[model samples]
Structure formats: C-alpha cells, structure tokens
Target: MRLADRIAVVSTEDAVRASVSYDQLRAGDGALYWLETRPEVGGVATVTCWRPGEGARDVSPEGFDVTSGVHAYGGGAFAVIDGTLWCVGGDGLYRSRLHDDQLELVSLGSFGDLTIGDGELLAVRESEHGDDLIAVSLTGVPDIRALATCRGFLGAPRPGSGMLAWTTWSEPDMPWDRCEIWVASYSPRGQVGNPVMLAGGSEESAVEPRWGPDGALYFVSDRSGWWNLYRWDGHQVKRVAPIAGECAAEPWELGYASYDFLDDGRIVVAVQDGPRHGLVVIDPDGTVRPVDLPYTSIKPYLAVQGTTVALIGASPTAAPQVALVHLTAADPQVEVLARSEHAKLDGAQVSTPTELRVHVAGDREVIALVYPPTASAADWRAPVIVRAHPGPTASCLLRLDWQAQFFTSRGFAVVDVDYLGSTGYGRVFREALYGRWGLDDVDDCAAVADHLLATGRAVPGQVFIRGASAGGYTALHAVAQSGPFAAATAVSAIVDPDRWAETVPRFQRAHARRLRGGAGRVNAATVQRPVLLVHGTADDVAVVEDVRELADQLTAHSVPHDMLLLPDVGHYVATSTQAGTALEAELAHYRFVMTAAAAD
Candidate 1:
C-alpha cells in the first residue's frame, strides 16, 4: 500500500466526518443524558438521552444547536432536572420534557454550567460586560434574575438543601491556579444572601463543588499538595479521602465533575495517577478502593443513579464510548451506549504506549508515553514523532488516539511527552513550570528524543517534533533552539505571546501571560530545520495573523518552510475535511524533509 493510503486507513475523511465526541454525562431519574458533538455538520452539538428499554435518541429539537458560548470553550450546556431537560441553545435557554421534541424558549442570553436548584435553573451567563450567575424560575413565567456578578469569572453554580455554592476567580489567575468556593443561603424565590468563602485562597485551588445527599458540601482541593476530596459540614471543612492522585482537572470548560455521590453514602470518583486514569469507591469512613474496569482512560465527568455509574471511557485499543457500570452486579460490567468511529479498527492496527520516565535539566524526571511502530519493519528502527500535548497543564491519557496511530501504522514511532508542568502528578509538579514554561517544557521534549535515540528505538537524524496551541508553542521554541529534531510542525501555535494574551478570551488571558514567563516570541530567524505551520483563519484563540507574521519572518530569513491556512475553521480544526487536509499536508512535509536528508 502507498504511504498516504496507509495513513488514510486510520484517518480517512469519511471517518473524520463521521466521528462523534461525547461530553457532560448526566444521569436523570432512570435515564442518561449527554451532549454529542458531530464534526460532519461543522461541529453542531446536540443533547442525547438513553433509557433502559427505549434505546438512545436525540432530545434536542431539529433547529436547535444545544451549545453554550461561555468561556469561549463551553460545556455543561444542558441539565436534567426532575425528568425535564433544560439546555442552552444558540438563541437562548430552552426546556423540554424527557421524551418531548418541542423546546420552549425560557430566556435570551449566553449561558453554561447548567445547574438545578430549588424550583430554579442556575447558570453562568456571559455578556459583553462579564460573566454572572443567574437564576431562572422554573415555576413561573421564567423570571430571570442575576444572583451574583463578579469582576472576574463565576462558574459551577451547584445548589443543594436551600443553599448555593459556586467558584470565583479573578484576572491573572486561572481557576486551577487560585479560586475560591463560596456558599450562600438561597431562597425559593431566587434570592441569594451574602456569600462566604468556604475554601480556596492564594495557596490553594478548590473546584467542582457538589452538595452530597447528607446536605454537606463536597469539593476537590489541592491544599494537601494533591487534589483530594474534601467535605464541608456547614461549619468546618474536612478532608474526606487523601489519595495521592488528583481527583480533579483544570477547569478549561465549565461543569466538570470529578466525583459524584452514591445513594449509600459512598462516592464514585475518577482519579488520574500520572498518565493512567481509573475509578475508585470512597466510603464515608475514608476508606478507598479501586473499581476494576477494562478501560484505562476515563473523563472526569461522571453521573450516578442508584448503584449505576455513567462515564466516557476508552482504552488503548477501544475508542471512547459512553458506558454505564452497574456496581450492584456480581461482577461490574461496562454497558456500552455509544462508540466512536475508530472503534472499527482491528487490534493489529493499534499501537499501545509504554510509559517512559526520563531526567532533564535539574535532574527532574518527566513522563513520556512511547508507542512503537505497528507495521513490520526489517530495519527495526523508525522515525520518531515527539508530540507535546496542548494545555501545558494537561496530561496525555492512555486512550485510543487516531492521530498517533495514523503515523505508527506507517512505521513512525510516536512519543507523547508529559513535561515538567503536566498535571496528574500532584500540585507541586503541575506548578513546576510557573516561571519556566518554555525553558522546562522544551528541555523535557528534547530529553525524550535523546532517550529514544540512545535506546536505538529512533533513527538518529529522523526525529521530528509537533504540537498544537500551547504544545505548538513548545515545539516552535524547541526546534529553534537547535534541538535533536530534524523538522517541526506547529498547528494554531502561539508565535506571539503578547498578541495572544491580548486577543484571547478573558478566562485564558492570565494563563497566556503566565506561560510566556519572560520569554519573547519565537524568532523565526533562528529556526534551522524544515518547518510546517498549520492554522485556521477562524481561530480566535491564537489568531491567524500571528502565524502569518511568523511565516513572513521565516521567509525573510530564507528558511525552508510551508504554511497551510484553512478558512472558516476554528481553533480546534474539528471538521473532518480540515483535519484530513492538515494531516496529509503534515505527512507530505515530513516525507519531503526525509528525502532531502537522504540526498544530502
């Protein structure tokens, strides 16, 4: 088979267009509700509900695109309350019965983080001024009222037992950096009393506040150096379970739940221990036990009804699926509800990753998931693609990544680096890149390449680096520093930090400023290898103008480079056509660089 055809086997345009992403899992009164985003229709999101005997069906009306624009990257778009579904559509708020196809418009505004309260619908409404926590009466003629407004941002408005709890953070500090959990008395008439800070401060980050069945407030806190479970009994805050792993993730989007309460006073939580993710049951007495399951990667959002837990899970070979676990069974079984298109690939085409720990500057150890080429190679050595994950704060989980497999099937080894600043290793490790973003992360990527080369797993001069968004920023810096990479590709990369910080949404402005860390923009003049720049004209996060400027600099320096700009595509090159085009262009660039190297 031709190289392009081999790559197409895993990442064809048809498969990309047919791909489906599931998010915001919620369990209603004996039904499961979640959001399904279809890339074929330009990323139209719709609400879906699944019942035991009825099967799964879409509940969102035909013309309604159930999505929230809050925080620019929206989630928590819909909530199920008392068998009725409340959702935020493009026009405004809408509510419908579980099986109804008609949607009743309640209000007009941009909202997210939908929460159910005492006869009210709570959400964070985004406007030209700022974000505000608003409440709409479910009983009356949908009376809308602003409960609280902040100068910075507000999200996760969880209401329980006649009280309200939410999180707030100001500029220059992302929610994971520093945020406070506040609570106040909430009246049935949609009135909020003076709020009091329950936890979180300059030295701590608390998020995902939930009101347990016991009327106590439960949240995740990083005060103990690891994000652990904590409980507030109205007067004092106490640690519920002290696990060494993180029970929560950074609030890039709203409505994230790492742990949910079970009816019998136990908690079913998703825990991230390095690159591996799993579930555990925590008893009220502070005892914790792992839940045996087949999947290795699980999203933080979970929904529980009775003893059943609903989550989105994936493994090395299996694609992400909406699954339900019946904990009451003799042996817990994962009942698959919906699966992604990649699930059709045979097991032989899959490349599983093995965790590798390497030491970089300051002798600090960093984790990297190394996947060997799946194709049979007589030479045994293959070109390596070193990938830096976006969200300098994000960790790459052991899931079925189609992009990674697309290269491995064609005899290219892939290495996903979780550098010094990655999460899942605890708060201290996550904060290690505070003032050393580019320096530490870049060094970590280089060290991984070096380790692979030394072990004879990668061709000495055939190593390449690539990243998107923050990861792309790291790749650009690494390739310019005369690293071991033969070439580099950056997609929607942040070439100018100052420009990005100013243009990005209010929620991530502080993150951009912090990640820059005294480092100036990438000097395209210093680049020494073949560079490929892929960006979308519609990318508001990292504007296309910045990439154009970088391309101009590369041209002035007489550097070998190619730039591909797709029109109308957003920051996330989500559509199948765009993704396939980008992947093909990237593969061609790598092959051209290899041919030139051979000629030399």
Candidate 2:
C-alpha cells in the first residue's frame, strides 16, 4: 500500500505533540483535587495540592520537595493525610503542613514514615539497624511506640480501626518478596497483640495488603505465575479471582504491579485489559465485572480515604493522567482532577500499535510496536524512532508516550521495540537478556528496523534511535555497529562499562554482562551515528562520568555529537524543565539529519 492514504507527513501545526505538555500536579484530594509530581530535582519527587473551592491554582504555584533536598535519595514514596503530605525526605521522614509549605522533621528523631491509621496518624518507620512501627498523632507529634517488634520494616500501614493488620518481609526481597501478613489489635496508646500470622507466602513476594471493610485481608500475589488476587479470611489464602491469560499492569516499582481493595465483598482492582486497562470489581462468588471507565487505555488504581480512587492512567493518543473517582459513593463519574497540562498540550496521533514478530537469535519472538507517521507520505519518506529500553530487564509497554508522538507528529514513524531481554512477556523472555543482552536485543532492534524498512514503513536512510539509560546505550551501540539511523540520542545512559561498574547502583553493577558478553569492554567504536548525550551533573546513580566518558569516546572516534549536561540532575532527569526541551531539540536534530539524508 502506498503511504498517500496515511495522514502522516502533512506539514501542519495539528500534527504536533504540543497537545500535552505536562502538568505540575498541584494537589490531589479525593483524587479529584490534587497535583502529582515525578521529580522535583535530580533525585527528588514532590506533589502539589490545593484547598477546596479556591482550587489547586490558589494553593501554591510551586511543588514541595518531599525528599527535602537529599540529593542521594530519589524522592518517590509518599502519603497524604488531613490535607498535608508526608513522605520519606532525604534520610528521614518529613511532613509538609505549614502555610508556607515548609518541611519539618516530625519523627522522634530518625526518618521512617507517617500514615493515617485508625482515625489518627501513625508513623511506620525503618532504621538501618532494624524496623520499628511507631504511632503518630496528627493532632501533634505522634507518640513513638514500637509495634511488638517488627523484623525488616513495616509495609505501608493498612488503614484500619479496632483490629489492625500489616505486612513485613526480610531484606533483598523488598516489599513484594515473600511477606508475612500480621493481624493484631491497636490502640492510640500504641499497644499490640501476639499477632496471628494469617498467611506467610514466600519470603520474597506479597504486597498491597488491603484490610477490607468486610473484615478480610486482600493482597496481590504472583504464586500463580500471574500476579493475581489472594484473600486471607482469617485462615487459608484463597484465590478470590482466577484472573488468567492477562495481567493488569507490569511492576513499575515495589508497589506498582496492582492495587486493589475490598469493597462490598467484591475485590476492586486495576488490571491489564487489552491495549488498556481499568477498575475491575470481582465478587467472592467469582464474578469479574468491570467498573465502567470514562476513558480508554486508563483506569483508577489505589483507593484512599475509603471513597476516592487514585488513577494512574492514559489515553490512546496522550500521556498518562492521574485522575480521581469516588468509588465508595454513588454516581461514579470520573472527576478530572489533576492532569499533566503537557498531556493536554501534546497532540497524540492515534495509530493502533500491534505486536510484530521479527524473530531472530533465540526462541523468543522479538516484539516491536509501530506507530505510523502522522502525515501523508506522498510528499516524503519517513523516519523511524527505534528505542532500546533500559533494564535490558525493563519491559516496554504500549502505553502513551508524548516523546514518541512528538517525533511522529514531526513526520517520523516510531517503533518501541522490546528486545529479547525485556519483561512483561514472562521470566523465559526476561531471562534471555541474562547471557545475551547487547547481542540479542541489538540483533532484535536491528531486525525490527530492517523489517520496518523492508516493509516500507520507514525510509532505509532515515531510521533513528533514542533511549534513556540502558536504552540509550542500545541506541548508541546499535547505531555504532550497524543499521542506518540518521542519528541517535542517549539520556542518563551507561556508556562506559568500567565507569558504570564503579558508580552505578550496586544491584545494577552486573551491567557488564550486556557490554562484555560476560568478559571485557564492548567498544562504542561500532557506533558512527551522530550522538547527543544528556546527563545531570548531580546524578549519583548513573553518575555524570558515565556520559562524560561516552562524549570523550565519541569525540575520539570523530563522531558528530552534542552533549547536554544538566547542573543538578540525576538518573531520570526528573523535574528538570530542560528535559522536554532537550527532547524536542533531539527531534529537531533528527529532522535536520533525515531531511539532509533525503536531499542527498
């Protein structure tokens, strides 16, 4: 088929991704009125909030750093109480409750955690020596009382009254590892019971423990291969819903896989639906019914305040937007509370992404989803954005990405190719990266690009690569070795194996497996494409030196390159205004190269 029928390549303003820019979430109350922030600095995360009636606008024009400027720690885990937000800031826990939104250390001494428990607030904390569960009163500084002696650390406090329940697990496993679900009684006086263990699965994997209004404990477990719902009704761990053949969402972090609650004897959860997902309520009798959603490719996740459902969601042509819905009450109209103004400003051209099987190198079918260029191709051939996701362990999903559409709007087709090592497809596929990495994924990416070019979706000379961290490495290394991309960009990437081995997080130190094929340095000499490198000087994770070495190597190789070094940025370049602009600049550079290539 000719590219004429395609709406892409049209030289018009409507084909731009400016429809969604990004919103500095002000505040999120009832998921209706709230602001959500990812990064306030190099290693910081913050959220915005506003008082009712006046609106999120009047509250504050700025986001409060929940991490309290601790540069080493990347801010993430947070909880909201009474109108103020409490989170792990820096080394300790801090709360933002002042009119000026100044952060104050609210613990007895060290930083642990503070959460609303049994009508008041309680601090569930962790120290290097061990874990201690403390009780905090929102009326004043919470009285610190140890919870009968915790082992590793207390899980996010299960909000409850009368009888209280919480989960705890040992180290290395994190929270999702095998955990022990404990149920005991609590008093404002901070007393506990002998605590009967309801269900202690593996020592490495149980989380999102929701003590229901029905007096039952609900949590998601992966014991069944798929992370499904498990119920502890004071006895055996029963399978409430045998949800199979699909997953709701892949794990983004410790508590990201799935969040659900027990409302009306029904287990309400957010799960992976086809192409998109949403809130699904499952009855104890085994009937799975979906709560009608207001949008597509999106759904509400966690339930807070017993009534409000917090949503981490997306649209077919837009980025994920955090919205709120009142599920505990009648009339479940999704209230559009907080939005990434960028999501609204960015123009997303909906091109259905289907999985491609460009199988090579191994048993796994290499996956690549193509988003056709958003213009009429009659005038010119198009470019393709080939992305190699980080993690080599990280799984790339088909969710909304403003960055991808940003290029598609600029007359470039995009393919988010999940090389052999990516997750979501299961352990078999994920483990493929173990011994393979650089070789298999690179082969898969190159093959996908070849497949797209051979099939005519991309001009052979115009394929380009862009990735963050490890993905950036893939992009750079691939363009270096083979394939014809006009250019490539690597962000916060691990370019030097030896330097990265020295600085990257100890857990990720195994990165050499991908570069050396389990042995020596994998030279960037294979790359000849013009490369743009982005990194934050403040980065403690990937380290500034990683990209610096890449820049040096690129220069030594005589490769065309431009480097953007952020002053106080870290791994993800979070909360930096320059991030989006820098991304846009990368797109512009791609255009310049591809246009030139086309001219030639």
Candidate 3:
C-alpha cells in the first residue's frame, strides 16, 4: 500500500516541502504542476501535470485546497477556457474540463470579489459595510451574471479585457491605506464607462496590478521605501524595477501581497532569505538576480506559456518542492522534477533529517523536526515520536508535514519539537515565552524528549508523547516533567495550567502571562504513562471544559487515561476521521506499551 508514486501525494519525508501556487490554468489540466498539499489538511492538493502539446504529463492524487477560503488555497487555481481550469476546491467554485484524456471535475460556484476576464468573468457576489455588487460572468461561468454592479472586485482572474477592475474603501482605510484603481469598460451591450480611477492607495501601496504593454499601468509600490517597480507613463509614475536591495521585499505591513508578472516587462519578486524567503528577478532597466539558492522559502509561479518559472525551494532537509527554471536557460539549472515519496520505503529517497539541537533550561536550544526512522543507521528499527507543534507561536518550520508523514511511513521515529517557545528563531526566539511559561516550555519539551532517549535513538521503553495547542501544554507538561513516554496524547489540550489561567477565554487570558512557571503543578504526581485525551465537542477554542476538567484529574489519580469527544470539531483535528481518532488512541497506548516494553 505504498502508492505515493506520482500524480502527487509526496512524503518521502525528511521534513516535507512543496509550493507553486497557480501556474496558469493550474493543477489538473490547467498546465504546469507539482505541488503537495495544505488547505487545512485533507483537500488533497497533490499535483504534477504539464500539458500543452501533450508531451503527456498529468499527476494528481491530492485534492482540496478548499476553494472558498477557510484554508483551501492550494494556490487558488488557474487554467481557463481552451483546456478549462479553475479550482478553489469543493462546493465553492471548482471546474476542471478536458474530459476523456483526463482532467475530470466540472461544476461549482459561490462567487465573490473574483476575476478572470476576456470571454468575461469579473466578480464581487457579496461584500459588506464598504458596500458592493460587481459580478459579470459571460463564459467564465457562475450561473452567468453578465453584469451585477455596485463595484468592488479584485483578482481571482479579471485583469485583461473582461475589464474586471475595481476599488473601494470606507472603514479605518487600509485598501492600500486609502484606495483607488478602478477601470470599468465591459460591453456586450451592458454599458459601463464611468469608473476610471486607475491607481491610488496612497501614502503608498498601489499593489500587484498588471497590464502595461498597450494599456500602461503595472504596479508594486512602497511609495519608494523598498518594494520597487512602478510605471504609469501617461505622464509620470516612472521607476519600473527600482530594486536596490540589501534584500528588498517588505511590502506587507498589511497585505496586497507579492509581485508576479513575467513578460509585460519581466519580474518575480519576493526576496528576503536567511529568515524566510528570497527569490528575486526583474528588469525594466534596474536589473536584479539574487536567485542563488540554499533557499529559505519560495513559491514563484509563472508559466503563462513561456519565460517559464514554476519554482518552490526550501531546505534543512525538505518541505516545499517543484522546480523548472528557464528564463531562457543560460546555465540555469534545477530540474528536480518530482520527489517526496517515503511513506515508508515506497521507494525511499527522502532528505531533511539533521537538525538535532539539544539541551533546554537556561541554555535553551531545543529545536527539532527530525524523523530518523532509518535511511541507514545500519538499517534502523522504530518506536520514538515526541512531536508537538501547535503554534508554540506557529512554526515547526520544516514543511513536508503529512502528519509527520504518517509517523515515518508507519514505522515511527518522528520528532517535530522546536521547543523553548518556538517560532522561526527570531525576536529573541519569540520572547522565549516572555517571562517563563511552563519552565522553559517544560525544559523545551523534556529536552526534545530526552534527546531521543540519550541518543541510542530509542528502543529502550518504546517512547511516545504527543501534543496540539501550545504543544498540548508541552505534552501535558512533558508527562509532568521527566519524560520517558510509554504513551501520551492531548489533542485540543492545554491541561490545567491553573485552569488554563482561570477558565481560559477572552482569547486566552493573556495566555497565562506567557507560561510562567516553576512552582510546579501538572500532577497525578507526574503521570505514569497511558494518557490520550482528544477533545472537541465543538471546542470554543481549546475547550471541552478543559478536557472534562483534565479527565476528572486523570480519573482521581488512577492515571491510565482515555477521553475522545470530537464531533463537529474546532481547533481543527485535521481530518481522515481526525487521523483515525489519533490512530486509535495512539495504537491503543502503544499496544499497551509494546506489551509492557517486552515485559521489562
């Protein structure tokens, strides 16, 4: 059952990776492909197609990057008309076409500030306070609205001739801080010609417009503090790619998001690296190149037919993969083609496993995301998993997360730690939980679970441990300090950190002053093992009355636990039936601790 063989499902785990949001037409028949997944987990987004002349390329196993928000942005989706492509996901606005030779799917609608014009399709099915109504869909589908009007649409497709231009602002202003970029002109006899603002949003921040060849507008601004690229020329706007760089790319103080046109005067832009991402390129006379590559994070799309981009770097072992590069291939290399297979020897060849970082107390360091179940350790055995991630501030930042690729493809040896108050190692490691929080995030998750059991890499007592939400209060305070872990779980958890700071709510009463600690508490005199809880009766943010008051204090001290709950969830358990109810309460408490750690 190791069929992760292309059409996309990727998980040759070493810490996951992939990202190429929308390469024209997009996914399935929309052309150029190779993606992994994410749209809140299980909307499958595994792709890898490339059809044009039919050099024959079509890979898809993933699905669900949702389609209407609330997580379904498997890069929103592209491919239009001719071959038919337009996906957002599920019952919101799908569409797939190409039939017999493949491409499947066909109808879906929900419409909102959309775009895609030429044969026509512009939108804004609904909006609020600022007032709305600006539909228009001739053939781009959506129960054909021909023209609705009240004006407020924006991209999803609506740039060229369908004339999908719009602008509006009214509350505390932040549509680029003020607003104005209207340009209506659609007429199959619907008459529209009174909207010509054509670019505004000042104090700076015009945005990623596009269409300068014969119409002249192009965009991306920072009013010149850094984001570069300008152009208006009906008598002044200037600068086309004024990039200078110490590493330019900082326009998102509040969204209009990155740049992307390539051929309308070439460009890509994202840049930053060594902290997150950096994938530059430009020209209109400023010239820039920086796409060197040890990669920090990337996703540069653009294969509209040529200039060929489709990138997606990421490294520390893996997570994020897709490459094509062909700015006209001077020496331009990078053809990875497709990887991410190991769901446990489904043809092996993973990579990302060497960030061990030990210790915890005052000398911090913790960090993790390992997965060494064996790619050679003289043929490694299994049983380890500590795992945690639940935004200890949001980042275990090492990508390819197929739920830790199903515990190292069914053999088990995951890690995913990043303790000591995690978050892309910055701002003093996200204020190392400011004050003190659960003793340096509980000795950084019991020093990444006893540094994988004093480095022999585990076998000694089977080991388990888990987390969710502040790493489920650091896996119930690392099983109440001193971690060995025969078993442990805690979905939507946060056990009694003093009633999560007095009946936690008010968006978390200041998160218990950032987890202060040391007077010690996580009781049942430091749990003995078998715990598993998994709440979610519509959790109002980590609430099942705090897992039924910590499962009645772990069943009045008998310890050995089991809870469950979940129905109409919250705090996202990330489906597959909540990962089969956390793999049947973690393999029935590790098969009763692997039959009592093989009878001691």
Best by lDDT: 1
Which number leads on TM-score?
Answer: 1
Look at candidate 2 and tell me the lDDT of residue 47: 49
Clashes of 2: 53
| TM accuracy, model 3 | 0.28
Order of models, best TM-score first: 1, 2, 3
Worst 10 residues of 1 by lDDT: 3-12
Question: Residue by residue across 292-374, what tens digits does model 2's lDDT show?
Answer: 77555543245443545556566555456666666665557676545553433433234545567786754546767777655
Query: Which candidate model has the greater TM-score, 1 or 2?
Result: 1
TM-score for each prediction? 0.95, 0.79, 0.28
Model 3 poorest 10 in a row by lDDT: 246-255
Q: Model 1: what TM-score?
A: 0.95
Question: What clash pairs does model 1 have?
Answer: none
CA-lDDT, candidates in order: 0.85, 0.58, 0.52
lDDT-wise, the better of 1 and 3 is 1
How well does candidate 2 match the true structure, expressed as C-alpha RMSD? 5.4
- Number of colliding residue pairs in model 3: 35
